[model samples]
Structures are given as C-alpha cells and as structure tokens.
Target chain A: MARVVVDVMPKPEILDPQGQAVAGALQRMGVAGVADVRQGKHFELEVDDALDDATLHRIAGELLANPVIEDWVVSRTP
Target chain B: MRIGVITFPGTLDDVDAARAVRYAGAESVALWHADRDLEGVDAVVVPGGFSYGDYLRAGAIASIAPIMTEVVAAAGRGMPVLGICNGFQILCEAGLLPGALVRNAGLHFVCRDQRLRVETSDTAWTGDIEAGSEILVPVKNAEGRYVADAATLAELEDTGRVVFRYVGGNPNGALADIAGISSADGRVVGLMPHPEHAVDTLTGPSVDGLALFTSVLRASATT
Candidate 1:
C-alpha cells in the first residue's frame, strides 16, 4: 500500500473567515509577529501501490477540493 | 404539469418543495438520488438540506448523484430547474450555475425571514412576478456566502442574470448582495432563500414565493 496526502487551501483571492478568526485569537493571546493565517483541509489516502500518480491527482482535484475557490497539492509518502 | 422534487440522503426540504408544487396546481413526483429516472416530469426542484451531511463541501457530494445526470441533461435541453439553499450549492458544484457559496463572513448559521428584491423576471421561475418586486422568504444556512471572480461577476451583472438581491441588509455577505441567479438561457435558477417554505400564508412570511412555482408551470406549458 501507498500513502498519498492532499492539502487543500482556499484560493488567496477568496475570503477565509475561519482563518481570520484564528489569527485574531492568536493576537489576543499575546502571540506577536503573526502576519496572517489561512485555513484549509488535509486528506491522507491509503491506496494500492500500483495506483498511479495521475489517478491520485484526479481524485484530489475532482473530489477532495473545489477548484472554484481552492487549490490543492498532492504528494506521496514513503 | 408534473414537477419532480429530488431527495438525497440528507435532504430536508423535499416534502416542502413537493407541497409547493402541489400548491401551484401541479403534480409532484418524488425522485431519489440513487435513481437515474426523472419519471417524465416537466421540471425539477433540488431543495435545501445538508445532503451527504454536506461532506467535502456543501452540495459537492450530492452534485454527482445519479439523478443529477438526468437533471443536467434535462436542464441542458432547457427544462426549468430550481435549486434552493443547499440545492443552490449543488447546482454550482455541478456546473449548472456560476460561482460558489462559501462559509458566511460572520461565521454563523443564519435563519430568518429575509426580504429580497426580484432583479429579473426573465427566468422561467420568476416570470410570474414583475421585475424589481420585493418578496419575503426564509433564508437559512451556514454556507450561503456567494463568491465569483471579477469577470464572472461582471458578466452575470451585464447579462442581467442576477435573479434575487437581498433587501434591507445582506444576510451572509454574499457578493453584491446576490441571493439568487439564473442561467444564461433563464431556465435554471439557484437561490439560497427557502421559497418552498414561503408558499403558504399561515406558515410563511408571505405568499410571494408561490409566484415562482406558478411562473414555472406557465413557462413549462408555453414551452
């Protein structure tokens, strides 16, 4: 079996209120030098070793993330 | 006329939508998410609810349901389709409409009777009413904020595709206070407000929403 990871983030141009809330909390907690924060989703999938990268990418692009407002990256883990 | 109301696993407003269809003096047919048949209905309504528990994203999972394949094909042939709340999200996910609905800017679930200005009477679903009319309907959802790129937004505006705009105040910080929109051909429409819940006098804020159902019935009859 192989493990593949997908990290999905809101497009930079889109507003992310959840991420902004976290950034606000950190500032209130006295954390300094925090410029900005953005929130996203992370998915780890276990698939057959024979599964190709293109298929994994397709899954991540089509189902794991919405291309209209998000960007995703797919990577494999040893 | 026979109108089809689809029920996905987590759909909560199918009954209400069917009731609205009946109130409009049309036969209501129940359609299942797993079924590929439309039962020869003239129109389709994708009602509100947390379909597939809103997994992945609101409407994302339900957009690809077996029934949607037929709905998409029917819509492509100019059959009138209405999508409400979560249904609106599903339509956007399914590429039946433009833009996407996201988490509310206030990060809260809003539920209340909202006032909306009808922006256009050109769509199959809005033709019964005059343009620029105001209607009171229930708006309820967490992920109702509408967003699109500048070019798409501009095109929607320029083409008069915007169907409903929030009046008094914007509930979810949706871009340009857009509560609903229509396809270029004016057959498919999706809105975040719950018009199905507003078809009755005793239970709804106003009877204004009934016009939408009547409009579609008339549109189906003529076309």
Candidate 2:
C-alpha cells in the first residue's frame, strides 16, 4: 500500500476570507512576526502500489480540488 | 407542469421549493438524493442547505450523491434545472456549472433581503421577468462567494449567460457582482441567493421570487 497527500490551496488570484480573518485575529493577539495566511485543504489517500501518477493527478485535479478556484499539490508520503 | 424538488440529507429548502412550485401552479414531486430516478418531472430544483454538514468543502460530498447522475442527464437533454445557494455549490462541484462558491469574503454568514437585477431572461428560470428588472430576495449563506478563472468570467459575460447580478452593491465579494448564472444552453442555472424564501409575503420578504417558478411552468406550457 502507498500513501499520498494532496494539499489544495486557493489560487493566488482568489480571495480567502477565512485565512484573512485568522490572520487578523493573530495580529490582534500581538503575533507581530506573522505574515499573511491563506487557508487550504489537505487530503490523505491510501492507494495500491500499482496506482499510477496520472490517475492520482486526475483524482486530485478533477475531484479533490476545484480547478476554477484552487490549485493542488500531490506528493507520495513515506 | 411537474417540478422535482431534490432533498439531500441536510437539505433545508426542499419544502420551500415545493411550496413555491405549488404556488406557481405546478405539481411538486420530492426526489431523494440516494435515488437515481428523476420521477419524470418537467424540471428540477436543487434547493439550498448544508448537505452532508458541508464537510470536505461545501457541496463537494453532496455533488456525488446518486441522484445527481440523473439530474446531470436530465440537464444534458435540455430539462430546466435550478440550483439555489448550497445547491449552486453542488452544481459547480458536479461540473454542471462553471465557477466555485468559496467562503464569503467577510468571513461571516450574510442573511438579508438582497436586491438583484435580472440580467438575462433567456434562461428557464428568469424568462418571466423582464431584463434589467430588480427583485428582492433573501440571501443567506456562509460560503456564497462565486469565483472563476478570468477566461471563464469573460466567456460568461460575452455569451450573456449571467442571469442575475447584485444591484445595490457587492454582497459576498463575488467577481463582477454576479449573483447567478446559466449554462451555455441556458437551461441550467445556479444562484447563491434564496429565492425560495421569497415566494410568500407572509413568511418571506416579498413574493417576487415566485416568478422564477412560474417562468419554468410558463416555458413548459409553451413547448
């Protein structure tokens, strides 16, 4: 069995209000060193060792992340 | 005319949608998400609600419900389909519509009587209304902002598929003030606001939303 992790984030051009709200709260709490924060989603998948990268990519792109507003990174996990 | 109102597990507006359909002089049929059959209704309404507790992204899980397969098939054959609020999110997730509905730009749930301009009357839901007419409807959602690639926005604008636009001001920071849009064939429509809530003046902000249900009924009568 193989494990894969996919991190999906809003495209840079899209607005992420939840991240902005969290960042604001942090700043109010005097976290001075904090920069901007963008919220995202993470998914862990367990697949057969024979699963191909193309199929994984398709799953992440078509079903896991919405291409209209999000970009995803899929990487195998040890 | 008969209109099917689909109810997912967490659907909150199916009853309201059916009420609107009945008020518009059409028979309303209830459809279950677990069932693949569409009940041969002339049209369908995917009402608003946080289906599946809105986990794993809004509408992401509900879009894959068994009934959506039949809804997609009916839509492909030019049957009118109206998706409201979370239903709109499902449509986007189901690939039946363009764009994605993300968290509200204000990071809060907005609920109020929102004014909207009827941008296009060519679709099955808006044909009864005149172009550029303004109507009052309740808008309520936590994640209702519409987003899309620039190219898709351009195409929607160029093709006149934008069915409704926020009139007074931008409510959820949706790009270009778009409130609702139609598919390329103008048979499928998805919108963030809750038109079903405005179907009765006694229980709603106004009766203006009844036009949407009547429009489809009128269209079916013509054909």
Candidate 3:
C-alpha cells in the first residue's frame, strides 16, 4: 500500500483567526519568536497500487480541498 | 412551481425553507445530500446548517455531495438557486458562487436581527424587491464573513451583481458591507443571512424576509 498525506492551508493573503488565536496563546505561555501562525488540515490516505499520482492529485484538488479558499500539498509518506 | 430544499446530515433550516416555499404558494420538495435525484423542482434552496460538522471548512465537505452535482447543472441551465448562511458557504465551496465565507472578524458566532438593503432587483430571487429597500432578517454564523480577490470584487461591483448590502451596521464584518450577491445571469444568489427565519412575524424578527420567497414566485409567474 502507498501512503499519501495531504496538507491544506488557507491562502497566504486570507485572514486566519484560528491561527492568530493559537499564536496569541503561545505568546501568553512565554513562547517567543513566533511571527505568525496559519492553521490547516492534514489527511492521510492509504491507496492501492492501482491508484496513480494523477488520481491522488485529483482527489486532493477536487474533493479534499477547496481551491477557492485553500491550497493543498500532497506527498508520499513512508 | 416547486422549490427543492436540500437536507444534508446536519442541516437545520430545511423545514423553515420548505415552509417559506409553501408560504409563497409553491410546492416544496425535500432533497437529500446522498440522493442524486433533483425531483424536477423549478428552483432549489440550500438551507443553513453545520453540514458535515463544518470539519474541513465551512462548506467544503458539503459541496461535493451527490445532489450538488444536479444542482450545479440546473443552475448552469439558468435555474434559480438560493443559498443562505451555511448554504451560502457551500455554494461558494462548490464553485456555484464567487468568494468564500470566513470567520467573523470578532471570531465569534454572531446571532442577531440584521438589516439589509436590496441593492439589485435583477436576480431571480430578488426581483420583487425594489432596489434600495431595507429589510430586517436574522443572521447567525461564525464563518459569515465574505472575501474574494480584489479584481473579482471590482468586477462584481461593475456588473451590479451585488444583490444585498449590510445596513445600519455590519454584523459579521463582511468586505465592503456586502451581505449577498448574485450570479452574472441573476439565476443564483448566496447570502449569510437567514431569510427563512424572518418570514413570519410571529416567530421571527420580522416578516421582511418573506419578500425573497415571494419574489421568486412572482418571477416564476411572469416567466
């Protein structure tokens, strides 16, 4: 089985309130040097050998992530 | 005319939407997310709710549901479709509308009686309402802020696709006070306010929201 992982994040220009809240909590906890934080989604898929990279990418783009507000990265995981 | 109200797993306003349809003198049909059938309804309404528990994004998960495929095709063929609140989010996620609904600027779920001005009366959903008419309705959501690229915003302004604008005060801090918008052909509309909730004075903030459903019925009659 091939294991694939997907990381989806808000666009760079979009506002991320949840990420900012997390960053604020970290700052209050005395964690320094954090410029910003952008929260995102992570998904892991175990695919059969028959599923090609193109199919995986299609799933990520069309089903897993919304292109309007999110960008996704797909990679093979060990 | 029959209006279809879709119900996803977590849909909360399907009943209200159907009631609004009936109040406007149209038959209401119930559609299921898992079903591919559209039941030949003349129009469709994607009612509000926390569909799919809003897991990935507000409307991201519900956008790909089986019934949306038919809705999208029908919308492309100039069928009227209205998306309210979470329904608005789902429409944006499905690429049936422009922009995306994000978290409110205050980062809290706002629930209140909201005032809105009808900016355009060209849409299939707002044709009965006169331009510049102000109405009160209830809006409730955590991710009701609307955003799009600068160019798209400009295009929407230039084309008069802006259907509704927030008035009195901006509840969710939507960009440019835009409360709702319509497609280029005026067959589709999406908004963050709950019009169905305001259709009855006995149970809601006001009866102002009934105009939207009545407008569709009137438009259907003329066409």
DockQ each = 0.83, 0.82, 0.60
Ranking, TM-score, top scorer first: 1, 2, 3
Off by over 4 Å in 3: none
Candidate scoring better on lDDT of 1 and 3: 1
**Model 1 C-alpha lDDT per residue in residues B110-215, reported as the tens digit of each score:** 9999999999999999999899989999999999999999999999999999999999999999999999999999999999999999999889988888999999
Residue ranges of candidate 2 with Cα displaced over 4 Å = none
**In candidate 1, which residue pairs get closer than 3 Å at backbone N, Cα or C atoms, i.e. clash?**
none
Error of 2 at B132 (Å): 0.8
Which CAPRI category fits model 1?
A: high
Query: In angstroms, how far off is B35's CA in candidate 3?
Result: 2.0
Top-down lDDT ranking: 1, 2, 3
Give the per-residue lDDT digits (tens) of candidate 3, residues A1-78.
Answer: 989999999899888889999999999999999999998889999999688889999999987887767899999977
The C-alpha lDDT values of all candidates are 0.96, 0.92, 0.91
lDDT of 1 at A53: 85
**Model 1: DockQ score:** 0.83
